[model samples]
Target: MGLGRLSALDPKEPVRRYQRERPGELLHLDIKRLARFEGVGHRITGNRRGASQGLGYDFLHVAIDDATRLVRPQDRRSHAMAGLVQPAPAAC
Candidate 1:
């Protein structure tokens, strides 16, 4: 279907941005998993010999305050729910 026809069939609501009044009023938490790598990759080495495999992944937990735009980031070896339950360390 054409873009114009699709929009007419299903109209989308107007986009709205929400902002917290206070610094601690709202916090957005997100987790990202990054692959673990050792030494240089084949892209640079031009060879796949001795490539590291099954090294596991690292999880990065990020928290952002809606009002103040403050960010808190934490790195963890695993992405377990238990790790999130615990408070992030004081040091970033």
Candidate 2:
């Protein structure tokens, strides 16, 4: 079998890109979880004593507009409540 025959065995799909004509036409939402800590950690304090325990996490909510490329980011305390929060007015 030749090298060309091997590549022809598995065909790949072409990549597609979509763009919105208006600012509010499309929006992408994302959530990121960040660790919560109190005071300085061992990296900064050089001591692991008095470490905080049971500290929860903070959720970062981000929204991006497809056309205008505008981004809105918000810090939330709970993931459950993150979805309940309302979106801010568009600056455009």
Candidate 3:
């Protein structure tokens, strides 16, 4: 890439650096919605008219420490569902 092409970008300043102190200093919670699959879908099973049914999604909660990049698997803090709160397995 040449400098002429790079000059077109807005705010051409360099990106800032970030650093954390300790392992448990900063943490971030993430909720990922995953679809519950019971059996083969219509596409896979070659049944075009077959309804997939009411296969709701499962919310996976994950807590990660930004500093050490260590995953702290815990529950009860982040529950995406409104009525019931459940903890997903740590396999994900």
Off by over 4 Å in 2: 1-13, 43-49, 77-89
lDDT of each: 0.71, 0.72, 0.57
- lDDT (Cα, tens digit) per residue for candidate 3, span 8-91: 766668999775776555656677777776777776878867576788886666766667666645333453343121222222
Better of 2 and 3 by lDDT: 2
lDDT of 1 by residue, 1-92 (tens): 56666567786799999997866667778889998888888999899888888999887888777777777776665545455534433322
lDDT sort, best first: 2, 1, 3
TM-score of each: 0.64, 0.62, 0.62
- Point to the candidate with the largest lDDT: 2
- What range of 10 consecutive residues in model 1 has the weakest lDDT sum? 83-92
Report the lDDT of model 2 for residue 85.
33
Q: Which residue pairs collide, candidate 3?
A: none
Worst 10 residues of 2 by lDDT: 80-89
